[model samples]
Target chain A: MKNQELPSLNYVFLLKQTTLEQPFISIKMMIVQQILFVIISIVAFYLFAKKASEIRRNILLGRDEDLTDQSEKRWKNMVLLAFGQKKMFKKPIPAILHLFVYVGFVLINIEVLEILIDGVFGTHRALEAPLGSFYHFLIGFFEILAVLTLIAVISFLVRRNILKVKRLSMAELDGFPKRDANTILYIEVVLMSMLLIMNASEGAIMLQEGTGNGFLISTMLAPAIVGLSPESLHLIERICWWGHILGIYAFLNYLPYSKHFHILLAFPNAYYQRLTPQAEMRNMKDIQNEVLYMMQPELAPPPPADGSQPATSAFGAKDVKDLSWKNLMDAYACTECGRCTDACPANTTGKKLSPRKIMMATRDRLEEVGTNINQNKTFVEDGKTLLHDYISVEELRACTTCQACVEACPVSISPLDIIAQLRRNLVMEESNAPQEWNLMFSNIETNMAPWKFSPDERDAWIHS
Target chain B: MLEVKSMAEFMASGESPDVLFWVGCAGSFDQRAQKITKAFVQILNKVGVSFAILGKEEMCTGDPARRAGNEFLFQMMAYNNIQVLNGYNVKKIITTCPHCFNVIKNEYPALGGNYEVIHHTVFLQQLINDGKLVLKDGGAFKGTKITYHDSCYLGRGNGVYEAPREVLQALDVELVEMKSCRSKGLCCGAGGAQMFKEEEAGTTRVNFKRTDEAIETGANIIASNCPFCTTMLVDGVKNREKEEAIKVMDIAEMVALSLKDQ
Candidate 1:
């Protein structure tokens, strides 16, 4: 190594030197670059925060619900479902590949923290001295993870495009949904490549100086670039460094607009997952009260002193706003993996019902409502609701409510909840049920059974 | 003929039975389901377990009504049934219908009716576990191929997968499993009140698809735990003209036949 001194402002001379002792850039240029980095970061974060708050406000537009009970169990669910990826293990092949990308993406971001600090403070390898040999080991481990992530991403891209996996290539994913998936894969490829190239060029400079950091994968590629001039190598390193950081910032902001937002929302979604038995549908308390008032008049609350009639709440959800916040959050947290649709009995039998589409439609309608609020300061009726507008009556009617979709969701989303609610609206609000269901309902109302069999003969089975 | 007592008779005698045998609508009215009701009653009698049926007082539990999206009707039925149940001071219930078991156990509590509701498969497993019920060695079903079809309400609905299989194990029959069993078990297209109405347009019926899976197992008998599943699977088998080759029988009926002392 050369003398341990801060390099002076001779850019060409500094670039020609192959010593690891000096900072990558001179102090004056470092200060200028630091300011640029700060501005870019602030802008990126500001944009992300703005969109994030809008999404929060949109989610809150849903009807009030209390999912905060059982905090201990909720925390366990968050850890198991989000952190542990327990449900993803249902399918082992993709699960293993997904584990690679998920673990790699998360662990490699530790190196980003160093890049961030170096960007802000004009230092090179800020964690290197503090962490000592451990820093090299950490970078080497991250390099191995990066290579694994690369392989996973490539296979995922091929599965989505070339081989066209059935669940992924479904018609609901046509147009922007398809593009969003492909774009995410492409972004991962670019980010991982930029990181590798930056580390390789840096390793080449260190190799010439006999002070390599011994990053596992990149050091092997460093020799290919060793023949380049020192200045050229340094230029390549700086360009890749800037490219990688900028790409990360861009990806961060893009998350709120893409299905990849699940990366952020999955934790809260898991924490707020429904803890009830899948067999139990949420009771209609309003209907219960309505019956109570009629059955036992003593249990009914007295009328207002002023004699104004109480406003009757709507029977069930007809639009996104009528749904619970957890349901809306489920929409945003959906990975569009289509496991729910694949497991749906109606979909498997070739009915029009696709549970994945239910989530996507909910999200799309919610976005439209959010934009309406943005422009008009409040939602002015767009004369459209989530029920008949986005999802069809055929789709809603086909569901057996067997909870296969709920059981199949890796993220604890209950598309059945949304389906049941919409069906309630269709029946009670619009009286749009099939004639056979109408007969059955009336039979239960009158004869106390779904069929017209007399209650008198309920125990006649003993005679047989 | 076996003598069956009613809750009214027990009440008039100044005594309450040990458990209320809630014969659901299907068990009461559907001819095919009536056999399951009879088989379960036979087991209860053979074991000397005191049980009483509501008889004339029994009504629907509103499982289908609620699932069919008629909340008003469902609540009315549930309210009236709760009144009857609470009046009788019923403590525990055993039902041959998974739908009734699920609704009364899970959905009725909020309406102020709570009881320890046990499905018959689970009850039979308990009976066998306690040694109150014993299977004959090499009974009629011994070594017979029987594939148990999991009911949606019983299996994934309430996680009562093992009790049915355990009961089958007690029978000493070869319990073959379908490709999808337990938590991943497919529905028989009879849940969510789909039993009453026609299924919406699809390329194939849900029950037909499920029955094909069951038949593909090559089990001579497709054993079921729910009345609705039994009805749907039977229809599917009949549709494919495989009813003669593949028989759909409830677990209770299987147990009633294989009883050691029968």
Candidate 2:
């Protein structure tokens, strides 16, 4: 192989010659394989993108409001929340490990571009022909990353399945969540192992040429497989190579259905995050306008005119569509790390509220609605909503609006906002507030205070 | 301090005070919060800063109604208060309660009530910095061990952990910090109208956990900026039967106690 020139196009001849003796695949078979690969890849990509757009459309089912102000702040938040993973550092150990997986997986994907090219073009290490020396270093770096990713993935598996970390084993993580997490970890481990084994087997076959030192892990393992015949080495390398690329395609399609959708949505989610101070709740703009009209009639701006009958609505959110698109995006972007619930006072103190569940319920309801649209070609009445059907009034009321979940979210997703919106539905739309809240509400209406004191008595404390 | 005039009184006299004191519902009706109001008023008087209260014209800032999800009631109360404040041509205002300060400073502007609203801690800190309101010698709080509890509204709600501490620093007290202070501070379980309702079933009340964090600092006094926090911490101290050992006081009360008597 060292004596032979390794041009990019030579792969067809080289691979065929290696398998010439016993049941060599014909040109027709090779063409069939190439066509099948392209079809599978195209189908995978099309389905993945279709599902992603479904989620986007579902999010836009929300009422329109401009969150486009302060582009600079949004960009900074994206960098800090998603890329920098600032909030993840609260738990230093897990964060460091997660960083390994995050950085490794992200950086390692650069090599996948080449693998994808190789699969499409029927070429073997085509980049090596273009850039000779750096290609070795590139593969070497990718190999090292693969090893780190492997270690991290194994640690995650142990933490979830064996060590049983409490946060991962929480009640909400049962069923598909538990399996989904483990499945991704398993996929990662297998993909990483196949990469190393493919490299090692290729290096073993190339040992006759005295060149097997490029990949760190593979170079070390090549000696262990030195006794194996070159044909067997080639066979093993081909299987590993095919398995790795196919697994990656499968993973890509799987991501949209999993909480791993955060992998793609995190950037956009962080960019659309609420930039105002965490303590500042967004005022219901309709009510704000109404207040302005009541307080300063002459200065009140006219309501927007679309020349259509204005729809009368009870104030605040009642359905998923009443939520802002950014909030819906937050639901889709949740990584389901349980960090928010861990930090939430309500959840930690054994209240019925779980911030993670709030996000999950939102995503679930959105997904259900999306499926309805897809099936019926329009949203049919499911007679279910995100508020009372998925998330309960008790859960909504239990939140203290402490902003702890907002602060603790690694990706800057604010479940507190979602809770507030749901609570708004309960009080404004359904009149389902606790009796105490109703009392306080009446007091404010009658006396301009949460207490039952008269306005004249407000001055009594001044004299006291 | 004894003759606190209303904004209406000042207007009728052709005298506009520098700032309108928005005595919130608690400061006007809750007995414990009234002490905070008086202490803050006394400090203003000692500094010779002419300020007037909203008095009978002052309504609740509608913070509780808004938080409790009653938008209509909140808007009704908010519009009425905004009308009164804007009518007075009030350019600057201050309040002792964090809920009032937060609502007036942050929430009110959207409803056409914009003013330079400062919380009393920040106002007091400014007063001291401006060479008004000097401390007497080492001041009354000298040699006293004080731990400051960060109110959700005053601390995390408004990013004002420093102003209260700065006001307390002037008293020359030994300031011991709780484990979770500043941005990481726990709520006193009183924000978002949680004060008006029974807490949802839980293993522990938020105030109990927060007060326990404060007491763990082993300070004799738990100083706070918000009246709600003061009440919650006071109750926490009582619950632990350490009322004799631990005293809960507002930042204004601490400053007023240490003021130089005229």
Candidate 3:
């Protein structure tokens, strides 16, 4: 108390005043609520994780011949990229603020564990006395960080609300949720602030109640609680605590279905990043050899019809299933953070392609894949492919494959490979590629240069 | 790890040469680029270097084609070039165009194309290092505050920013830099096959922005390496109406100055 610390949280005093704090929560209801929390969480998390794994296997229908080499390399880079927050670091303000929120949220999980242990195990005074100092210090620091993060999020909202929301309509593209989306984000932030204040208020109530075991901030709020009776103070604590836990519950459940789905995808996606630098163009085998192989289709054996192709099919993703496994995981890890959209030359230049949309498209395709998995169907089984239906040919062709998205991706997803594979499928398999590309292909074949020169003229540019 | 044992290993399989030079597409194809290349060759020959040519056997190094989203075309051209080079076992590579140099040095390896690649300016600088190359008194470039454009392929692709600058620096001329140069250098609208494809429809091409940055320095001589950059910037100069005051030159063209007295 003499430490000149901010008012400490008098958790012990608040808990001891069972008459007021425990109101409406009979022992029977408490037991039922605890059971529901445990059971529901276990089932939801299990289903989500299991569904993710199942969808992954179902989608990874294509394979590169050098799968081992490509995969191992991608995995290492993805790890570095996600854990290091490399892309976030590219934009300083949002990145640092996000880092604070991210770390604060993660660290706050420890406080949740403490609450559960004390609440469920009757270890109320157990950790409090022994880890009191350490616990108090962390809670204090986390509250301060939480407050800062709240402020950052509030400004983010105002910027989006008072400023960016209007600009959204004038942007070259559409589909951005105008007011409704911003409203939800604002609500999320508001809820977070409420949780912090409630926790801090509880701390104050304890300190003012003369609970020597409280932390500085909570204890400081103790004086503020002096005006209220024990009953009212206790009531406030229960309301805040329940609201905080429910907020956490709702957030976890809703997150899997959100654009920030990268939260779940990031870990696995990082472990499966593209091993190759996007700038280094990979060389396919001899053109004549490919033509010769294509001519002799009898010699080439298609794999068993389990929907899996032979790994050596130099033919790139002939369909959605042809994408590498990591590509599927990458769709999940995409935070939709818009760094790629911001950096995209095509998008910035008013081209139809937004790298952000491409990532989102991939995610939606995966969701479609998830839907299709139980039905034992392929992405292209119905002549209505997920990619063709989701992303337009113009958007696909618009990509220069400059690896801007690859470079911009914080999770290290190789969108270029996916796009290139789609191109391969369009050009080679179906002849459904854009007319311009077909002409360009013909020009290169006939004239060696797309400039429509003679084959002999290829070398003429050398001496001109 | 990488070394130029001798040019004779590829050219004649044992005959030593005073210098090994690489003549790239721009040098061989484009009229102005050919002029610069020949001038560079003339200077090197005058310095007692016995050089050889790949002649008509060379196709596009696949730099432009591949960057433009046509990897299929690139591989075809690359495969042919690799076979041709290994046929002569061509070693000790040198190039006039930084784009060609980059492909020959870096991009080729993935496609089985590897050689001891150096841009012409670096080779010229080496000749200076060995005290074999000497500058002619072309005088001080008219005190033109020259701004250097770090070609994406040359500077960022292979980290060859200094060699070209060294050639400029040796001339005792003014050397101003673009705001965005070197690793962070903006593209001149030629990268990623952009030279072939229509540019993203915008008020100005990215290269136009780059050229403007260079022009901001008020330097008359805008230096570049890759022909794509040179072509774009030269047009930028004319369209911007700075042509009367500004000119674009390659490092090879500049190095030819050292041999001007030849």
TM-score of each: 0.96, 0.93, 0.80
TM-score of model 1 vs. true structure:
0.96
TM-score of chain A of each: 0.94, 0.91, 0.78
Question: Candidate 2 — which residues are off by over 4 angstroms?
Answer: A1-33, A291-309, B1-3
Q: How good is the docking of model 1, as DockQ? A: 0.84
Question: What is the docking quality class of candidate 2?
Answer: medium
Winner on DockQ (2 vs 3) = 2
Write one digit per residue (lDDT tens) for candidate 1, span B1-262.
Answer: 5758999999999998999999989999999999999999988988989999999889999888778777888898999999999999999999999889989999999999989999999999999999999888898788889999988888888988898899898888899999888888999999988888899888999999999999999999999998999999999999999978999999999999988875
The Cα local distance difference test for each model comes to 0.91, 0.84, 0.63
List clashing residue pairs in candidate 1: none
Compute the lDDT of residue A116 as modeled in candidate 3: 60
Give DockQ per model, in order: 0.84, 0.67, 0.26
Q: Tens-digit lDDT track for model 3 on B1-262?
A: 1122223344557654443455655565566666666667666666666666665555567665555445566667777778777767667777877667767777777655667887877887787778687776755463658888876666655666687787787776789888766655666766655566566455556656767888888887887776778888887787788888888987667666546464
Scored by lDDT, the top model is 1
For all candidates, the clash counts are 0, 0, 37
For candidate 3 chain A, which ten residues in a row score worst on lDDT?
A165-174
Instruction: Tell me the deviation in Å of residue A372 in model 1.
Output: 0.5
